[model samples]
Target chain A: MRFRYQMWTVFLAVACWGLGSVAQAAELTVSAAISLKEAFGEIAAQFEKGRPGDKINFNFAASGELSQQIERGAPVDVFASAALKQMNDLDKKGLLLAGTNQPFARNRLVVVVPKGEAKVTSFEQLSKVGRLTIGNPRTVPAGQYASEALTRAGIYNTLLASQKIVFSENVRQALAYVEDGNVDAGIVYATDARTSQKVSVGFPVPANYSEPVVYPIAVVKDSKQPDLARAFVTFVLSAQGQEILQSKGFLGANQ
Target chain B: MTDPWFSLRLSLAVATLATLVVGVLGTAAGYFLAKSRFWGKDFLDALFTLPLVLPPTVVGFYLLGLLGKRGWFGQVLFAWTGWEILFTFQAAVIAATVMAMPLMVKTARAAIESVDPAYERAAYTLGKGRWRTFFQVTLPLAWKGIAAGLVLSFARALGEFGATLMVAGNIPGKTQTMPLAIYQTTQTGEDTTALALVAILTVTSLAVLVATNRLAQGRPW
Candidate 1:
């Protein structure tokens, strides 16, 4: 009986410790789009090295989903979205700190196929493919961009009506589907295609085919560490940050 | 990119806590359901079993509605304590507990029910109180099934993903269990990391299931 009580005491102590650790230091929670995974990982490391005793925790997901989380009161310090639409919606709701929204980087939509498979080469040829995957337009900006590009090519409705389109949760998942050969082709960000050696870019959707893909970053209005969050944003927009983004196939913000 | 082992450690901690909670609550509920006969008992049983049959995403959606900041209970909690439960480690444990409850309840109920009632009758005749009779007589005989149920529940909790993701949000080193890690790694094109996580989860689940089978066969070592 004594041993059992001791075990429970230890358990409770550990649980309290876990909860307590979360409150220590200046932990900055950054909710960014899934496509920013590689670039932000490096950027966060650089930013953290410059500022000791501060940790940056990333929550990567669809920008729309992240915006929804912010609206519903997620404890986020910074929000970096893959598209302006999600940021604009949150800004309209007054969820962002005023004057904090800034365009950080840009990317283009590209069609990719399994490394050696090249039957479908262009947006118009997407309809002839057995299966085509893209992020779900409702929640993933890449999907919305891809949908617009396809609409410009006059194949979006045809692909939809023919039931040849598979909607993924995010751009990375769409890229994974193409890489895994589960789909003949997928429309994803150019940066996403570069991450996987198993998938090759088929063609870049013309910039005018859809709205220019601009990435935005801002501090959440309810951020506990607004200074730290703003600093992280500035670091991401710095020359060093732009270099990392460009190395990963992203266009500059002013492009 | 925190410690690679963070998700594994978090998952173990969450599963252990969730199983401990389920062990106590599920066993009591199981014992009560087994020994009692009441009006609307079938409805109650169905209610307890619903989580097992419903899709995990549906269960997660319901949790989000109940525990989200704007939710009824969540609104009260936030107003009173200024503490938001969503995206926390506690939320992962709660999601695991809800997901593992049905398994524990069903298995424990069957175990307790299978025990002959004559043993309880003898304990009562000897002037033993109900609580003592249950702990001394009923529990000893039903422990094997209950133990098996606990093992299965632990495994279920370890793999709980959908609900945890919905309520806990995939905060690495915090709420990212092995399953969530696997999903995230795969999506991020980190096949090597995903493969490793998948293998670890598969082996752990296999060991747990094998132990459960042994316990259920009445030959636990």
Candidate 2:
């Protein structure tokens, strides 16, 4: 009987502890583009430090994939996307909180090659490369941008015809392929290129090569904690947040 | 970054829960198929075996279409409960269960069929009902094979990657299993972390398979 009483007390204590934590912290699920991983990690840490009991969870993927998840009723509180098109589509579908859409950062597309490999230095010379990788244009914003740039360089069709193009699930995967020396060259964000030491930027895709890469953030309409979600959005657009992003090789929204 | 043990714990929980669900449903389906002879039984067997042969991504796509909020039954569920099933821990279990069911059913069906029906008939003649005969006679004879199937189902559930990723959306410390963590770490160029996770999964799976082989050989140890 004494052992049974002890076991009951322990069970009750464990149950209460579980309930206590759930009651204390407000968890915000932010689904963001893969490119925002490092910057957003820093910002979330700082944001949670200021609001002691609040927790932030991130779901990082391609912007298009994130949008599709939101559309399919994913329980996302906030979304930070790498491209305007994805955000615009979510807005048109009434999935975003009204007036919460704001562009917080910008980035440039660049061509990267394995370190110490300099066979192709210019965009026009990409045709001579053995294997070129980019994110899948269907679901990755970086891939769409890379495709537009390749089209402008007049080698997109030739690369396709010659089977030199390898599509990756996301920009990071494209970067990984190049870093692993599996591909001769890859097109990815300048910010992503900065994250790896095994790859070096061959050249930045010209500004006129594709539409500007702007990152927009917003709160989801189905968020249970709309105020907390809006606060996170505000924090991401703050000067401190912009500083973090810029330090990671991203351009300020105004730029 | 997620705590290294978080994915391991989550994968164990998801796999265990999925195995429990698959054990019950698959065993029932297997027994029914073994005992009953009906029209189009071959088609039914083929249907049950489809998921085992179909690419996991294709199965994931079909699950998404059937369970997404805009989907047929999902729309009704959302309208009544305002709850979405996608991207949750429950979604991981559902994905694992679907992927692991075929293994359990096939193994259980073969095991039950291999059992001598004479024992069941003797139990019936001794005044035992069908359920009692099954529990007392047939089950004792077939438990070994059924147990092997359960272990196989658990291993399959633990390693499920593509379907779970599609449905559960890879949120670290929430829905990211070990396989998803390895994929994410590899993409992020964290080769050491990926290698560690890969080693853990390979060792665990190999141990499970060895245990399964021992069980199949009728060794209790």
Q: Which pairs in model 2 have colliding backbones?
A: none
| Model 1 chain B poorest ten-residue lDDT run | B212-221
lDDT by residue for model 1 (A1-255), tens: 354355457556645544443433337989988778888999988888998888998887667657766776777899999889989999999989999998999999888999989756676677799999998988677888889989989999999999999999877778878888999999998888888999888888899999899999999998989999999999999999999999999999998
**Global lDDT scores for all candidate models:** 0.84, 0.83
lDDT string, candidate 2, B154-201, tens digits: 899989987887777778767888888887777665678889998987
- TM agreement with the true structure for every prediction: 0.87, 0.88
Write the residue-wise lDDT of candidate 2 on A41-106 in tens digits: 899999999998899988866576678778877779999998999899999999999999989999
Q: What is the TM-score of chain A in candidate 1?
A: 0.87
Off by over 4 Å in 1: A1-26, B37-43, B68-70, B78-82, B208-221
Q: For model 2, what is the alpha-carbon lDDT of residue B16?
A: 71
Evaluated on CA atoms against the true complex, candidate 2 attains a DockQ of: 0.25
